[model samples]
Target chain A: MDTDATYQAPSVDEIKTLLTERFAGKVNVTKTETRRVYATLPKEIVHEVCEYIHEKLTFEHISTVIGVDMVDYMQVVYHISNYHTGTMIELTTNLDNHDLHVQSISDIWVGGNWHERETYELFGIIFDGHPKLERLLTPDTYEFYPFRKSYKLRGQE
Target chain B: MAKDVLDIKAESAVMDTDKMWIIMGPQHPFSHGLWTLKIQVDGEIVKDAEPIVGYLHRGWEKEAEARSYPKIIPMADRLCYAASMTYTHLFCMTVEKALDIDVPEKAKYIRIVADEICRIQSHLMWLAAVGTDLGNFTVFLWCMREREFFMDLNVRLCGARMTTNYPRIGGVRNDTTELFDRDVMRCVERFEKVLMDDIVTLIDDSSVFVSRMKGVGYLTREQTVNLGITGPAMRGAGVDFDIRRDDPYDNYDKIDFDVPVMTQGDSYSRYQVRIEEMLQSCKIIRQAVQKVKALGKNAPYRLKVPSNVPAGRSTVRLEDPRGESLMYLISDGTDKPYRLKVRSPIFTNVSAAKPLVQGCRIADVPVVMAMIDMCLGETDR
Candidate 1:
């Protein structure tokens, strides 16, 4: 429990500075609250940004990966947590309607593998370099992403 | 008459060395749930494993999108029957975050007590499962016997045993009933005595039980974190991270408890972690019950929150009995949520089955996975 004393974690302000200085125009810091940082980055640079975060910032654990259908565009949210500081950074990246492909961070954090698979199955967002991106909670033979807005629930108009 | 003496050695000379896949699940007694675990084995040693879930998937996230905020509380309860209150509490907390409101002190304390009670019973259920998995009926019966008292406490609190939809958006469904604190304290004290004195001796003192769980299904701290394992399993692997203590929510910060950590990172370490956690839950329940009593009976327990959540996104993660269960809410200024993503801890934990059971015997698979405390209700959700 006293592990926090060993690692010199960066303050939230320092993280903002480090990320902005590194990515510059490619990253946008959306919101910062207590122990929480929200940012949006271009889909093209997601893999690079995540690599930087994992290696430099020491965000070890990937909490979850969520895929959302924004009607016109799709958004994939990655919640990565730093055990040292008890801080979580929520990285949101929007995927174009035509191209729903984004670079996978599974190589950096193996924990994100299943999350990416689930996201891929549910929202049809393909992780470009995922090892085995298949339907997780859905049948392999089942077609269509059930979580999309276009896939209506039973009795729904 | 010669008992197949015609070239018996020659007939047995060509042994089949090929690895074969063993599908255990969807119906196997070892699986405890509807999921399937396909393990490729070579002469009884499991080489690789893959867990196939979603048999119990009810489209929980998609269903939440169709219902109003309040209606989802009951749905959340069904996520994990053993630890139903935690899921509902998480859903409520997530909604309250999206709505940007704080619950009353009394409500928070009461929730702490309830959540702790849920944790104890859930661990007891897991203990029972471990007992049966290890082929010890006495342990199973004893644990189940102890668990009944906690179930009674649940009924006393909210007239429900499992699938307790007691937590609501603003605070909880209602105030703690009369004598709820007294009953909780009594249950906690009795449970601690029985567990430490009798139950611990039964398992820890038994050579067979200890040997079965000791050196198998080992995971390093790195593998645990890299695989996204949480709750007691992560602590067992020596990660030393507990959402309640590290990232406190509700009245968890106010209450004092220790997050037991074990560095062995074996099946036995995981088992010991859960046992210690149940005792810690008792300590938390006692303190939280006292806090609730100190707040008096007239303090507000439930708040009248607005039905419609503003257009925003809020994420809340809590220390569920199983692991760190997170609910990410996306509201669109309507009574319903735009999207509600539930990060079920078991989902991530179960994903590590391949690594967990590899190199272990076929018979050891049940005990190894039992340490994971599988509950497909939440895993598939």
Candidate 2:
């Protein structure tokens, strides 16, 4: 048998240690009130953390990737689920309102490509390194991001 | 006669070939609602496929933020019209979890019965549509004729056939009456024989249909998991993960049924799985009806949902016939939810098509998509 196969999976603390060592405490890790682990990492290290979690921890499926606009900065949250252990890892990053740039995780999971594109089209989050970063679930001629907090509804403020 | 001949000649000669883009939907008989598929095809082969959605986008999530918890129940019915009751049950169940409301045992059994009945109707509709796509017109007519019985039963139970907002937050809306129970049992008895005979005739009888679908549109187990495809689509690929069995919601743990799986992972396997699932749903409904009868109206028929719930989020997964449907509710200590995100199974299942449709023939695209049965309303919302 392979040595990697025989090795035990890393505990949650060990996973946290690896995350801290890689990002040097730039991430604000918070255990959500629920059973999920929520970590806010820098936009620069978003791809790296995703790679680490996917490769080392085997959180293979990115269940959901949503973008929330907070007027000043847009927040992108990747809800990754570990199928083996049945735990959810939420990785968050904030981008400036003027410059919304973050790395894409399509390389790790192909499912993230369309979801990230949806976020980009709905909230104007720029996902760098996405292979086919085109409009998904939106018209190509849509000029404004519909989900932004600054964008008012058709009749409402 | 000369004028008619000239008009026919003019109409035939008016074809412009700048890659004529024809809108196939938004009002076509094939489409359900206002979903338009812009197809740019060269002759019979498709060069480009674009799905234009948002025709039924009621801004459900945005509207949920403004409305009270009880008021959102009706809107949930519009999410997936075919499985409207299932969606409503999931929505109310998620809110019930955030409020820490425990549904009574009798309500749980009724909810299961209602859900199984809806599953049977959904699968029957899918079979009819699949049959129609394959030019088997008689099968479509027969399936609809059988489905009308269930629809009539639904109307008797909830006063509505398609949009039955019967399941509430704590429990169900109404108790099971003797008349409703007798109708359900009679339907189940008739459905058992008809379903078996129909599956044998419709699917097993035709060698041409089997040959056409046997190995077409195959999704390997690895690809299905990586693409996050769930429900019968994934089960047709031979993945043994059902939310009802894995995470038992609404007394599913108390019931006994086998999760049908197919290793072939093709359109044929999908058909087989759904057919087998209809039988399993019939069994579950029969058992649930027996249980409800034994319980004898002792279950609380109504639940008074709290005005204000705790400020938190809860994610609940329920197994719809399509697959595992997820509902995420975020409450801000108010009667209404701050965010109610529905991760529709059809949306993710349909996304797997871009990869599956790459090298297949153009005619197979609709068959593969129809097997998934993506509700455009759920996808846009």
Candidate 3:
């Protein structure tokens, strides 16, 4: 999904500069496109970015968080929306699929916990510090991650 | 003292014993479409509950990617069958947003009428099912009798009953007929008196229903918000947040009606809210019908949508009869959507059952679940 209509877009340089100034280089801001910015930071800095966006950039609500498998890597996308400013920032991170480790953002937004558990159950993504990481939708005996690209549907493998 | 010690030991032994688990259907009376709930109960009192989904999962998101833009309308209707029109309307609105298609004023008014009719029919069905759950079969008969009028009205307009694939990507399938307007008015007038009185006599007057439902399945406003509950359940919790009012789609902003919120947040409150909501829906339908009649048949009904929609994501929230139905549509400038995610209300409402049924008796489970009135198709899809 690429957009070419660059109408005074938010500058990546300014975003990166702000992140560096606030987070002291612990945060890595990667530019996906003129409109999409993917911020990857240490698990410890998740709260910091969440807090900074909520307070400074006015990203008031977490739209959704999608967990995807890149085969060897697991990617978690935090889709944040600034309803007042009409801007969206998709923060993403890649971790080893087997490790599947990350801190929970439930403390920031209470709604994040259920979605996180759903992702965990579907893709085997592990939220390290989540309050309850037990199976949310699937059966307890469900062994395989159902949403992975390689994960075959019934009788398809 | 020795007997007391022995009694304590016997109770501990009973608690430690292996409990029998019963798997209630992906097909059952309680389940509408397809979903399973695994329950571990020690003789009626449930110790634990787990919801098992993905039975009716057709991977609609993947299907949407393969289907052309206009072709996905029918599929959206199948997501929530009871309120099929709402799903189709939401999908159309989302695609219209992506393609930047402006619908005609006449089309908007017609759509509002159709959707409000769907809401009335859906709530009527809910009332029937809720009545059936409470061991009152006559209410179901009365509700179905009243509901047939609207169903016939819908068939007269769109030529279908349950699944009316009447809404299109740009606008709607057809213009309203003179007969359609007459039948709708007839249905509205009949429902205004008969159905309201029947609901009050059948449900509100019954002491059994009141005793069983008055304080059962309670969810506080704070808990409801935390659980992401929407629609009537959230309104029953006293939130007063209706998408029709908060984020007005179609001509909901122009219409006049109260959301009918209840502070009790119990099963009874939910039933009362839904009963009141049916009346409010009738009011909206009356206003929309008036608007449609004024516009007449010559008003524009069709719209033109671009072949390649703009590459953007849009989230459209509409007030479905059950709850707040959110559709997240992502397009990559192609005929097919890149991702189509549905945030169904039933899924969240059903999840709240885990907390609602924690200490209640087993007999109360069915009544409590009926109050939620979750359609398994919506939850699984």
Candidate 4:
């Protein structure tokens, strides 16, 4: 086991500044709370932004990927965590209704593979270049994306 | 006899040999829950594997979207029966964050006590599963025996044993019952002794148990982090992070406890991490109970918040027994949440089944997988 005794993790401001400097206007650091950073990124630059976070910032883990269906658009939320600093960055990306597609980050963080698969199955979001972007936790035969807001509950009209 | 044996070997050598895929669950005893593991095996060795979950999905997340905030408390209780309080507590915490209200001091201490108790109960259940998976009924029986005391503790705190819907949005359901602190201290002290003296001795002294879990299912610290594993499993792999300590919430920062981490990235280390965690939880329970008592009985345990949450987003993560479980809430200024997403620990941990079971013998599959401590309730949800 290697001890990280000398490793110094940058504070939240440093991370925000680093990201804003790298991605410029493409990356927007919306909110910064205790041990948490909320950022919004356009779908076009998600892949590069995530690569920078993983490779440079040392955010080792991807906590989860959540897909939400808005009436007019779609959203993908990625929670990335850096254990060294105990800080989590919430990366939210907006997708147009016509193109519910985004680059897959499974190559950078292997854990995102299953989460992408789940998002694809539930919200019909296509994760381009994902290793196996198939239905997960849902039957392949099930045609409908049950999680979409348009899909009504069992008793609802 | 030598000539006949040589003839038989020569004939058998010409026969075709190929890898076979064996599906192991959804009904198999090796799977503690409703899930299947399809393992590709060449003779006794597993070359690759796939885990299929969701037999119990029941559309939990979507179901939550339709129900009101308070109505989902009992539903959250059903997320994982083994450690229901943690899920409910997590759900309530997320809502409270959206509501932007702080629970009273007494409620925070009580939650800590309840959460620690739930952690012990969940770990004990996992230990029992590990025992049975490793072919030792005695260990299973003993663990279940110890777990029953915790279940009784749960009953004393709330009213239910398995799914104790004790945590409300602003606070817990109620304050500690009469003599609840006394009962918890007694149980924790007795359990500490039995676990250290009897259970630890039985497993540590037995060479069979030691050898079975010592080196099987190895994962490096990098792999553990990259694969998004958390909780004790990640701690065992040498990533020193615990949400309770590093990312404190709900008076966790106020409490003092040590997060047990093992550098060895093997099954045995994972087992040892959980065992040490149970002991640490005992220490936490003791301190938290005293804090609850210090606050006096008049202290408020539950706060009355508004029926509707403000339109916003709140995300909260807690150190669950299995791993770091997170809940993300999106409210639309209504009683019903716009979206409720649960990131179950087992959901990600089980995704690494291919790496976890690969390269091990078929017989070792159960023992190795047991270390992840499968729970379909939360995984499917």
Q: Which ten residues in a row have the lowest lDDT in candidate 1 chain B?
A: B4-13
Task: For each candidate, report its DockQ versus the true two-chain complex.
Answer: 0.71, 0.36, 0.17, 0.79
Q: Pairing residues by index, what is the TM-score of model 3?
A: 0.81
Model-by-model lDDT, in order?
0.90, 0.77, 0.75, 0.92
Clashing pairs in 4: none
The top-ranked prediction according to lDDT is 4
Query: Residue B339, candidate 1: how far off, in angstroms?
Result: 0.2
Q: Which 10 consecutive residues of model 4 chain A have the lowest summed lDDT?
A: A1-10
Cα RMSD to the true fold for all candidates: 3.4, 6.4, 6.7, 3.0
- Residue-level lDDT of model 3, residues B203-263, one tens digit each, is 7788998999988888887677666566787788887667787557877888898889999
Model 1: DockQ vs. true structure: 0.71
Q: Encode model 4's per-residue lDDT on B1-381: one tens digit a residue.
A: 766556767777886778899999989888998999999998899999999998998899999998999999999999999989999999999999999999999988899999999999999999999898988999999999999999999999988899898999888888889999999999999999999999999999999999999999999999999998888888999999999999999988888899999999999999999999999999899999999999998999999999999999999999999999999999999999999999999999999999988999999999888998899999999
TM-scores for all candidates: the values are 0.96, 0.85, 0.81, 0.96
Model 4, residue B303: displacement in angstroms? 0.9
lDDT of 4 at B367: 87
Second chain alone, TM-score for each candidate: 0.96, 0.89, 0.94, 0.96
**Which has the higher lDDT value, candidate number 2 or candidate number 4?**
4
Name the candidate, 2 or 4, with the larger DockQ value.
4
The regions of model 4 sitting more than 4 angstroms off are: A1-8, B1-16
Give fnat of each prediction, in order: 0.60, 0.25, 0.11, 0.77
